[model samples]
Target: MKIMNILQIHNLKPQFPCTFRTFPHHSLSGSLNFSLRKSTRLSSSSFLLLLVTPIRPTFKIFTVSRIEAPFFENNKEEEEEDEERNSATNLTEFEDLAPDGVVYQNTLRLVECSMFAAVTGLVYFLSNSLSIENYFGCFFSLPIVISSLRWGVAGGRKTMVATAMLLFVLSGPVKALTYLLTHGLVGFTMGSLWRMGANWGLSIFLCTIARATGAVGYVLTSSFLIRENILALITINIHASLTFIFAAAGINTVPSMNFIYSLFGILVVLNSGFFVFLLHLLYSVFLTRLGMKDSLRLPRWLEKAL
Candidate 1:
């Protein structure tokens, strides 16, 4: 009996220890009821814990992933900034490499020269009086000379040679020979005039002096030695004066004698000035439309060429 009693006392002592750990003696009945309810909940939770999967190990992985997310965002931002910088650099490089205005100007000049030459050729072919005398009969030589002054010796020489060749081809052998001699003289004189470090005005003046000398020579030669044609003197004088006037003003020099000749020369100068002005205007408008800078640096080759 005493042994059974001692066993009962041992069980009661374990309950006392559990009650003391959870609640004091002064705890309310409700608190005791809550403690009993908590014990029941703990017992059920332990059973559930045995059946459920563990979650503690994955907590470290979740924390690391969360921390790395900001780095990825920073990396993306860095990439975007780098791209922007590269784009700006590329744009700057392009601007430095390519110049639009100079290219356009050169192209336009070539086209204008070609068109003028073609028109002159067609006019000569249709006139039926296409002889070396007639082909050169117009002040066309003046434009050739002036083009050199404007574009420089190389361009001028190129234009003059091209014009002479075209005339030769169109006028046949007799006219070609005469035209070549006359034009060759003009080219040599103009080239020499430009090469002498003369300004535009002086170049034109030199051309005038050359023409005047030629005219005087023609008169002396034709009147004294070659009496076959008296008209050659008149032709030579008219060509000289007309060429000087035509070159002084930028325009097509053509063979014509009268009061109208002066008016035509004035008209041609005005027209060419207008054409150049319009080209500049168009260039400005194009640049504005493209959002480009107003002033551009000249190309090195073009600066040297000019």
Candidate 2:
């Protein structure tokens, strides 16, 4: 029995020792390999999450910022329209306040009218016979009447007085005096008539009557006096009155005896009458457009004082 027990103990020791060594080696190697694989997987996943997270947040922030930026909605056409409207308003205001422009225009018109009257008067005196009756001096009166209506009676009178003085200096005293008597008186009368509210037709009729009366007076005076100078003067007066009558009838017929004389007389009356009517209407319309209640207003000083 002792022999059998010894053999069994020896065999068990060899087998058990070899099995324990092999088991320790296999367990340690397996556990180390599994730990390394798990660590590698976890590191890769962390890197991918860090990259994706930052990129998504940056993209979202850029989109949101762009949406919040301000933008204008007005088109180019609308802006241009607004500018045009503003410019029109400014121009209207300038025109309304342009008193200097009005005064300058009035001064220029007066100068032109005066110059025309002086030239026409000289031509008339040179072309006609020196007799007062033949001269039909009323031709020079129309410009003065027109000037008075457009600029006022004061301006008209100033031009007429200057023209009369110029004529006296250029021509002999007799011719100058005759011109003043006929033209100056006619101008003054027409101006007065216009101021008293005479329309175009009435003003023309009154002027015609005045001319006819003057002619008749001259004829009667010369016939009674029986003087050669007076006779010549009366003949001139009758010719002038006839010329005016023809002009009023709108007959453009020229006098065969004196073409220049008849033509000039007709032109003077027609031009003057037409210009006076046109300028008066223009003045009235301009004043009305500027919000004036009446063309004949009080003087500046009087208005201010009141």
Candidate 3:
């Protein structure tokens, strides 16, 4: 019984063939070969036993763990839309400027308009405080011109109103009223007409009419505020001038009321025409320097002269 137990435990001569399959790899392919040793001696119930031994080195086993693969979603269209949204927004007013060298985005426009209006008021205030020449700083209309060139007629009108409001607060309602009627309206009309791509001929014509209207409006506002007749003063000045001219020529003839009114109207139109022309010459160069090529399409002769 002891010998039989040893033989069964050892099993040196197996009834079936033995094979050890290796893990799948390029270097290791075949199965393992094992040599078994028979068990020895039953000496008074003591037993020695052995099973199998491999001659060559065995390959190591690798345990694989279960893992889930992640899912992938495509959002190419949404990503493209996000990129397009970022394209229009800029960090600064000059950054990502449009072809006319201005950014027309409403949020940016509002900020710039407010700043320019403040500048306009400040310049006017300083000029008055310093008791400078009345004809000085006519270019304070820069705000209105820039607004019209950058954001169109609506922007110019907005700038004028904002500047007028600022001036009303800083100075008085009369100063504000005078500004809006004269230089403010002139800048708005001239800038808007130039930006519209109108030629010098049409632009000058339209702006002259606008300037003349503004002059009339200014006189009316001044007369109403001062509670005096400004038209009477202008007529008196005109009558004195004609009288002096006639006395020098030894021709004594009284100028009629119709003639006086006609002369005043003519003088106003002529002054408006010259003022508008001067603005054209100045802003053509000014806007050109600011990178707006089409702000005013100067004539060939004028362009060459400039």
Candidate 4:
């Protein structure tokens, strides 16, 4: 009976599964007390049994005193210092910005993106509704380019989505998609290349390809949406031009479907090339004036021309 009482009091089972690592730098201090009373009626066999019986292992449960977390006050001060530093170093331009371990820069990015999106949507709507496509069309993609040049790929992507959504709500899916493919895609592709410091030749070449792809996509999408054969119309116009040239040259040859398509593709590629070159030319001078001289690496000839 004494052994049972001692076992219960000492908790000779694995009741507390706590480990030392769980209480880091904690102080543990506890004492154990065991007492047994001698009984006059106890037989010799009972005493012998108590001596012979093995005692199970006991666990000493300590009262762990947790030290106040180290540097707890210092941590709050450090965090405050970081916020102050970030605020102090806040910049107007996010180009090549270093991570500040804070959300301030991201908040600035969101504001810039919203401003660009609003400008793009408003300009696009006005240009279309005013029926002055010829003049306003030249700058349809400027906001995208500026956003990309200032804030890079993510900024450009957000601006594009916002502009497209706004256009869809105001105009329709056709206009929105057209804007996305041609104008938005051009701005995104060229601006990303320029921001990465890509040279003029490579940037122009890749952007030309992107612009051509967007044109083809726009043509097919618009044709399907409007239930008209845009390609067929272009083929007819190309054939008419070819017939006039052939007649002037006294050549009695009619262009085949393959030949006509090839000519059409060439025209589209040339148009895309010109558009990309125009962007490079315009931005090389414009960005330089904006105190972003390093944004583009202009060739000598282009620099002289500009």
Candidate 3, overall lDDT? Answer: 0.77
Candidate 4 has its poorest 10 consecutive residues by lDDT at 17-26
For 189-249, candidate 1 gives per-residue lDDT tens digits of 5544544554444544444544444444444554665556554545566677877888889
Tens-digit lDDT string for candidate 2 (1-306)? 564477576753222211111112233233222212222222333444544763311111223445553475467668899999999988876765576566557667767767856875676567555555444443566566666766667767776777767777777665565565556666666766766666556766566555544444544454665655654564477667777888999987645536544654565466555544554454444444555425333335434543
**Local distance difference test, each candidate:** 0.49, 0.57, 0.77, 0.79
lDDT (Cα, tens digit) per residue for candidate 4, span 45-160: 45566569865434556778988877568889999999988876675234336455346678788998898888888888888899877787767777777788888888888999
Which whole-number lDDT from 0 to 100 does residue 110 have in model 1? Answer: 74
**TM-score for each of the candidates:** 0.35, 0.35, 0.64, 0.65
Please identify model 4 stretches exceeding 4 Å from their true place.
1-101, 302-306
Q: TM-score winner between 1 and 4, please give it.
A: 4
State residue 297's C-alpha deviation in candidate 3, in Å: 1.7
Best by lDDT: 4
Between prediction 3 and prediction 4, the one with superior lDDT is 4
- Segments of candidate 2 deviating more than 4 angstroms: 1-106, 129-138, 200-209, 216-306
List pairs with backbone clashes in candidate 2. 133-236, 133-237, 134-236, 134-237
* Candidate 3 or 2, higher lDDT: 3
> Whole-model lDDT for model 1 versus the true structure?
0.49
lDDT, residue 21, candidate 1: 22
